[model samples]
Target: MSADGGPVARHSPARAAVRENDTVRSSLEPAGAPEPIGSMLARNAARFGEKAAVRHRSGEGWSELTWARLALDAARLARFMEDAGLRAGERAAVISRNRAEMIVTELAVMGLGAVYVPIFAGYGTEEIGRLLEHAAPRVLFAGGPEELEKVPLDRRPEVVVDYSGRASGGAVPFAEALARAAFSDPGDAEVRRFLERAAAVDPFEPCLMMYTSGTTGRQKGVLLTHDNMLSQQRALSMLWDVSENDRFLSYLPWHHSFGGIFEKTTALYNGALLTLDDSLGKDFDRLLENWKEVKPTVYFSVPKVYQQLYDHVVTHPEQEREVFHEELRFVFTAAAPLPESISRFFADRKIPVLEGWGLTETSPCCTITDMAESRSIPGVVGYPIPGVAIRIAEDGEILVRGPNVMRGYFRDEEATRKALPGDGWFHTGDLGEFYGKALKLVSRKDRVFKLLNAEKVVPTLLENKLAGMNPYIRHVIVVGSGQDFLAALIFPNYYLIRERFGDDIERAEREVRESLRKTIEAFNAEHPVKYERIRAFAVVSRELTVDDEELTPSLKVRVKNVLDRNEPVIDAIYDPSSDCDCRFLRKVFRLVPDSRKCFLGKDKTLDQCHTCGRVVFAEGAPGVGEGSVG
Candidate 1:
């Protein structure tokens, strides 16, 4: 198809001579090779018109839109927004879950000079209001009526278009809006106008306004240009063996840059199939059921997803191998720190999990393991990708500079100054060291704390190591900043523990503590360091949820929040006397033989410390592999 979405014309000699190799991109045929993403979309539509460009699960089954079809649909959508008075430099808010329309709307919005702000599906009215106040978008494309209702009537955009057909309350239905604006034929003047408008767009202009997940504080908007996104895709295409035929089973929330820039836009740029996990929600069971049908070549998942899948593999280990071994081209992980256990699990099966690292302000990917070029390193997220430079500060903080870096945080100059320094480097806050040529990611630079004994503790590294060894440990937070010894507040998967020790909380707690001790001991056995060891632990009964501000939307534990929330329990653990009557952490006094009559009474043994048997806390226990905790 041509730019007008009509019959294609034979390519000119110059166009035909453009590099078609996987490594040599078309834009790079002339030296400085970055182009607008809209141009890339046009190229894909022309090259592979009838090929499946996008897909989503439908009532009948999987439904796909051809490259030609998407190009036409995008044009119509752009025209509709234009007709509704959306102009260049204005903003449009996309309040939807991961869907084909969301991608289409983004591309359409980009083609116009308008930026599109992605609102993650689960945001509450207050959160939505907070975002709306910042962006003040002229148009809002809601996934459903429920999504549309989150915005106050006064806060509603000038034009409200509902993607899902099952929406009401004064919103324009998606199909009707497009039909009203669309021209019947390519020969129509309006069609020509739409094409001209798209072609006139400046690649360097701001095209994206992505909001952070706000784990630390208020969510800030990160503005990115078309060049920034297009540069990343082009740079990535050179490293990975990405072809026009590669298909992806995408489940990553599209609101984040990792999903939007890497998965969705990558598929569109390469003319590959992006099979949406239309499980209605990000239901793992439903996702697995859909997996049998899609059988994607490339898979991108967070660490938790792999942990859940590993749970299934524990019962049916070989089944997962048989399914993914031959079919999967590459399995990648990001968003949160990936446990080494999952990497080793896949590695043992000769299918490695490639890890990548980045922040939202950097188009979410500064470094990625090139599956074709480099060997997999379990914990290290590989070398920096092309066009990106990495430097380590004196404090071990990773600093990055690249075309993919955002222009700045939208309307937040203070944040922009602190994050993206005037020196042109963005402070990643993540600590990393070079392992030969590859980068080995350590814990956050700020999260590292010194114990009262003057020993340094990287909490996340210790947490990941412990979590890796145990199956029942859901989450662990190492707490010992300016304290004598390290202690952990553990959150176990209570359902599984309850199944093993039915209705017996005391027995279950004891067994879990014993099991956790064994696991952490195994980890310490591998390392000879005494200061890195965790001395004691207290298991929490309740689960952590984003609702309770325990976990971020990406499901990362907010350590400060956790620490602040459990300050009393943490203080109680470090108390000098064993007589404290704290609810969360209590002391079990070591009774003498005479006192045993009151403590253990007739059940007291000669060898065992009878009072210790009743205690939930593992107090001042020496490190089994090294030395004492204090």
Candidate 2:
């Protein structure tokens, strides 16, 4: 039986009915039955006072914070925040790279019953403005000056606090704040009162405003409460055993659910050691280096990270096997359905890869494959976790009712109504099926483009970027819906190509590929956002025509026909092993740093990025190989 496949054992008296009812899929441990994370922090501090709660890298070397010290510091920060006039349920934003201060500041804010809005540190001025406008935080807690700098002058918060002690534009240093909170007069009447406020926080009150990439062209705030998050700990406890002895290597974004609930909160609740993703200036390889130093037993990452590890393992087979041997208990992956090959690769080395599926609305995890389940099944997302009931709607969309479900979208009753259609059934827009007992995803109901990480992608914006890249690129349609990376079906401006590079069709093809390659490379460099990068593309020589069922009456490219017509070619690009031959409708495109320079006949040549696929184009006349593409 899967970890989810267990008889109900623990719950409150009110939920005892849920435990007995076969219809209500109650968790093995009653959801929302355990104390909140705030209490867990207190429990952990008392239980494991001297033990290191977390580890990170400073300018000099590695640094750590003991549980007792972390609790004290967090409490101090909360007291300092209370002195700064931050009231309960108020909002606070934290913009920082992956660092220890991120966790410290977040926990501190949450402890004081304030909402913690975690924005991606690298967000540009526009993104920063949008989030600030919605959140309207009382005080902005940032890592350093650079983070505060990202906020546009017009959208600056009322109070800016640099938790990293870096000075920038009217922001107070964290050290100063802490010192003031500590050195206040012993007779100050408000100190004890404020500490009492922090201690008397309600577990069900909304404490997090996790914003999701709005599919409808605006960011939506998903409100998570203490009870919603607390339920996550007890729910997943049935699957993976997080012990005080266990160490977790965390690099996933803290704003994202997997990192926040699975690793961060899990670490605190279990009194385990959490090693931050101290990559030292965006150098992800530093994570691998740190892993060697702190061999964590349990590791959690997204599909992208696992894919990157696959690349490393392939590049350095011996070293990878040495690092990922049997010592590592579990490497949990979610955010997207992983290719079976990845699960097999780790399995071959005696390392287990646990695949899971969830949305930001569900505290990030709903169905996670445990020891009983196998990732070998391609689309499996495992059975619904304990205390979560899954039912399919008439239109095939997945409907979930669970304690992990969020209260609602912040200040958007309409969206909340649409998402949670009352009677406790929340509409999860994703289509799912049961592969026996496990939940296997099918497709999405809406046109919202979710990349490998479930982050929404704007189709029109990406298509425009590609079309503007090369003059020879006439029509570009971004495909790979619900897949790992984006791929494009491009219609070449053959007339312009021939006019520029002579009427030799063969020469034109080579030059077109070269120009297309350069355009993609520039795009990758300029606006290389995660989950939206074009890792592969295909070019078709035959002009798209309405008569040929490729373009619509208004001359717009018909997406369905284009995809259906180029199904083999698209499949060939993503999964080349099935095709086995390097033959496509026109040409295959892949993005990489170094490409192999291949020579066509008559001293002409084009470079092929070998890393993107399993096949290579035949070194022949490119013009003659159009409609009869093999």
> Which one is best on TM-score?
1
List model 1 lDDT by residue over 1-630, tens digit each.
212232221211112212222111112211247677678766776788788888887787778888777667778888888889998889999888888888778878888878989987677888888898889999998999889888877788778999987788778988887788647553456544555566567878898998887666678999988888878776665555556667788877788877877777777776778898866324667877777678777778777777766665665656685456455666788877666666767766655466778888888777766443334454577656666777777777888877888899898999999998798788877887766555677887778899998988888788877776787888889889998667788788654565467799678766776687677667657878877766656666567776677876677787778888876556545553233223444222221122222221112223222333333323233322111111
Question: lDDT value for candidate 2?
Answer: 0.67
- Candidate 2 ranges beyond 4 A from true positions: 1-27, 31-34, 183-199, 280-284, 448-630
* Residue 237 local lDDT, model 2: 67
TM-score of each: 0.83, 0.70
Cα lDDT of model 1 overall? 0.70
lDDT of each: 0.70, 0.67
* Candidate 1 C-alpha error for residue 187, in Å: 8.5
